[model samples]
Target: MKYLLVREDDEGEDELWGRCANVEGLFVDPVPPPREVLTFRGCTPAGPLREAVSRPGESTALLGNGYVEASDDTQVDWWELVDAVVLAHHPSRSDPSLVDVVVGAGVKGAGGGGFRRSGPSRFELFVGNNVSAGQSLRVDGLLAPRQDPAKIPMELIGCEPTGRLLSALRRPRKREGDWAELWALDRTGQVMAHPAVGLGIDGTRPSVLGGTLIDITLTDGGDDRPAPAARPVWEAWYQGVPTVPNQWAPYSSQGRSAWLRLALHARRPRRPDRSGGVHHLDGRFVTDVPGLHCAMSEALAGPGGYFGWGWDAFRDCLCGGFGLTPPFTLIWHDADIARQAPADAVSACEGLLSYAEEIVQVLEDVGVTVVLA
Candidate 1:
């Protein structure tokens, strides 16, 4: 049996402790053990896991989280405790007796909130009382350090955790219009085209039919190349549109990045959140582009090809960092943009190619590479 232990903060120990993902446990103390003895338990504690307190229960005491149970009840509940770990020196290299079974005559921590000792590593997540949709948990912890005494913000891992890491280590902040961005990479070490994301809609503002636009930059493909400090090429809407990576510039190198969504499109237009060029992708009607039907159909297979940014690619690109819906067959609505007949939608979609080209020019003027892709 594997379990985690949460205890009351006694702050009576001086030793080292190890915390990790698939590694186990957490550290809550304000001061860390500079140097001390450690103990290994359960599975072998290996690289990066600098273990100290050798023996469980025998090692120096560590502080655990605690909170008032109730004003009227005057009781203490374990779950109310904040998440954290303490450290102390130990002489042996062994694991905590985190897992123990009960027999006919025995029980453990009977009236205690403390869990059994950890037999293996596990992942723990943290959320703040006021942290909302667009805010990163990392930023909240850093900006309010004492509020996060346990250093719970340190352990974060995602595809593009750069911004989170910065928030954890540096605690950088936003001034007016700038949103701290996060970048990610794939297994191949290629930078993820999708950088940052936030939920599309908020429930508080009812009758809300749209989302915010993200700011981005267009930079030449180079390592030292810096994105223009001025403005981004495009700002994509967060909702009611396709969300996916339209293209990955094989031409780009490891040094440079293309903030694709930073200069992309989305359907929502409640009010532009961030300032930048806004290319609206009207989902309800096909205005500019001629041949593209609101829905996908065989008609797109022919003339719409030139103006097409690959159906899936277009949707993914539009969705930006948020997840994308898979491209599906087009389902036509009764009234058509052509207003002629059912057969004209396809040809009309092809007509939109000219408008598409015009938008391409608009993007190009802003230093964005609007490849046919």
Candidate 2:
């Protein structure tokens, strides 16, 4: 495999920065959530706080005092205002794990005590104890590194020192907003992964092969890549290898997801919707989420056409310009293959209903008459 470094110039054109004989630190883990400290005030305990204090290691949500003015929004869950889990409670010294600092205590019925703007609280929180949606997404992990928080570290081995790279190294220090993209390519020069990165130059030295070795750190801006195991699948696709139906069925859930992601990224631009006609989706191989996507893409726009990668993306496709507008008829031949098959792990976690069932409903909802045969 070879690596290429590229950058987008002011005109938004991709300029090749240089090519590397070898590159390291492309694969990475997702960035962890930022640590936060929250403090609550007052004194008293409606429910025994001992349960939380007893199990310091276990995570538990801290509830609101129920005294604040309720929001007019009907969707609000007032009962559980702070949804994050508590990592450590510091009031009691029973557990030695907690940091020695009492910020606030969970006071039970501090009569008429609304959300205080300022005052000494007896509780302090850290890390997982703050408001957050959830952990970093799995896709993020494949795009960047997990060092110094959310930065990617890379060492370019035997780099063909370009004027651009050499000039950057000669600078006294890196300027703000130094950025580039690292692309991985196969032996046949097919691009595999390309991720936008914020570059931090470490140093540069001469290589044994007369090339320069440059070490740098990178922060992921975003990327088009997949897990290592799934690269072969994409490579084959790039080589125009015939895809046997259900070819993706045997891959692991993560692999299937990677395959689908790469397919979505690699899909051809949406062609104008047909004026009028029926489209037939070959559903014989629709045994998994990725397969469903592959079959659907080919069905709508011919070979290698992309309709959507998932329900949301599919809905977007149905809105228009994806080779087929709404109100079209779709004959899903051998649809039972999808109906009877268990969903891949990626789809199963999305919802209880099978993805096939959801796909049909989405189509029908948008006026696409689905003939499940």
Against the hidden reference, what TM-scores do the models get? Answer: 0.17, 0.59
lDDT of 1 by residue, 235-298 (tens): 1111112234222212122111222232222223333222223222222333312223222211
Q: Which segments of candidate 2 are over 4 A away from where they belong?
A: 29-150, 174-177, 184-193, 205-225, 238-247, 284-287, 343-353
Worst window of 10 by summed lDDT in candidate 2:
134-143
Residue 216 displacement (Å), model 2: 6.2
Error of 1 at 16 (Å): 51
So what's the TM-score on candidate 2?
Answer: 0.59
RMSD, each candidate, Å? 25.6, 11.6
lDDT of 2 at 342: 62
